[model samples]
Target: MEYMNIINQIIILFLIIIVGFIAGKNKIISQEANVTLSKILLNITLPFLIISAFNFDFSKNMLKTAVTILIISIFVHGTLSIVSLILYKKQEEGVRKVLRFITIFSNCGFIGYPVAGSIYGSEGIFYAAIYNVGFNIFVWTIGILIFQSGNVKGKGLLRKVFINPGIISVSIGMTLFVFSIKLPYVISETIKLIGNITIPLSMIIVGVSLCGTSLKSAFKEGVYYYASFFRLVLVPLVVYFILTLFKFKGIYLGIPLIVSAMPAAANTVTFAQIYNGDVSCATKITIVSTIFSAITLPLMVLLLK
Candidate 1:
């Protein structure tokens, strides 16, 4: 039953992607417009989404769980970074960079919150939000370095890493969570309403990205299948087993497992465009892994149950 709900949500998201793909194919969303959309998503909607995730009422037990999740999230990302670095070292440089980035970062924000909420409700979102802190931190720091390697040096790279929207929003969200600061009802709702655009908008952008690339070409790259396997199958299985070894079960185990299993971050395409990485490769990996997740996610849920 819960697995059906997960499938339904994914199908809805995929439908939105189809909408964007059709629009892009018809030239409704031009290349220039897609670039602008990416900027809007990264700077505007994503930040609000991050902030709104922290809007729930505070409790000591929740706070404790939040802290635990934060620590685990950081450790998981760090481990994945090392693993990706070692695994993809022999690939071509451009593809290597994007592969490492996508493998290390999943679609935690755009897909994770809703899916987590569906299964665990508000409590699930809280864990997703907390886990995202580590995600934001690593993505800004190490993830940027992956894209910018040898291109931007020293202070330029540092500026990009430290001053991005991801870090800023994480900072704001974490401050609110730690201090238990509540926005007035209207302000919170407004933030959430805007933040809600992120998922659909992200999917549309991904669809737009897929416009020119054929399904054959998209799957032509064998490396994409390798990356998808790492992202959708291996990562979640490793996370689930590791957490269980530590006796972390229920929501703690489930939330991280789901988040880790998510497809390549949609931001892979956005960031590739921003940093002049391999945009086509990014799109292919993201879409392929996402399509494959329809099978893997339900399997993960069944395992969780």
Candidate 2:
């Protein structure tokens, strides 16, 4: 039953991506329009989603679980960051940088929360919300730093890491959670309505991005396959088995498993473009890994059984 549910969820998400792909291919949405959509997603809708996820009735136990998940999240991402850095140490500058960034980050916000919430309800997104705290921190800091061929900008590093939209959302969400404060019904409902746009919009952006890429290149590169395999299969499997050994059951166990199984984040390409890394390689990595994750994610859920 759990397996079927996961399959259903992935199928639904894939269908949505196809919608975006078709829209992109047919020129229903122009590149400018797509960029605007991406901005709306990251800046507006995603923050609302974060806030709404924390809008539920609060409790001591919930707080504790959130903290526990945050700790585990840090551990998971930190471990992977080290592993990727070590493994990619000998590669060329550009490829090595892109590989490291994609390897450490996953689509935890766009894909992770939706799949997790599907299986585990709001509780899942609640945990996923906290899991993203670590994600936002590292992605903005270490993730960006990895791709920069030039000298590190130490001036605003602290500001950059702590002041992003992701971290800001997490902070507001945590404040709401910690204070047991609830927004007015009208306001909260409005936030929820906007927040609901996040998943589809994010997936559409991904699909649109994919429409311009050469799937052939994504497959032709042997390195792409190795990186995708490490990302979509091996890393998640390692996280799962290790967590199981410690007997961390329930959402504590499941959240990490779901997150670890997510594909390379769509922003790998975005960050690469911004930081002037290997944008083509980043796009290839993002697209190919996402395509493969549809298969690996379900298998990972089955293994959880």
- State each model's CA lDDT, in order: 0.82, 0.84
Worst 10 residues of 2 by lDDT: 147-156
At residue 277, candidate 1 shows an lDDT of 86
lDDT (Cα, tens digit) per residue for candidate 1, span 1-305:
36667667767877887899999999999868998998898899878877887776667877788888999999999999888878787788888989999889998876776677667765676678778878877887788888887554668656765687766876787678778898888998998898888778877877787675677788888889999999999999999999999999887898899999998986888789888788888888887887787678778877686
Which residue pairs show backbone clashes in model 1? none
Cα RMSD (Å) between model 1 and the true structure? 2.6
For candidate 2, write residues 128-169 as lDDT tens digits: 988988888788778877876445677677788788888888
Give stretches of model 1 more than 4 Å off: 148-159, 270-276
At residue 95, give the lDDT of candidate 2: 81
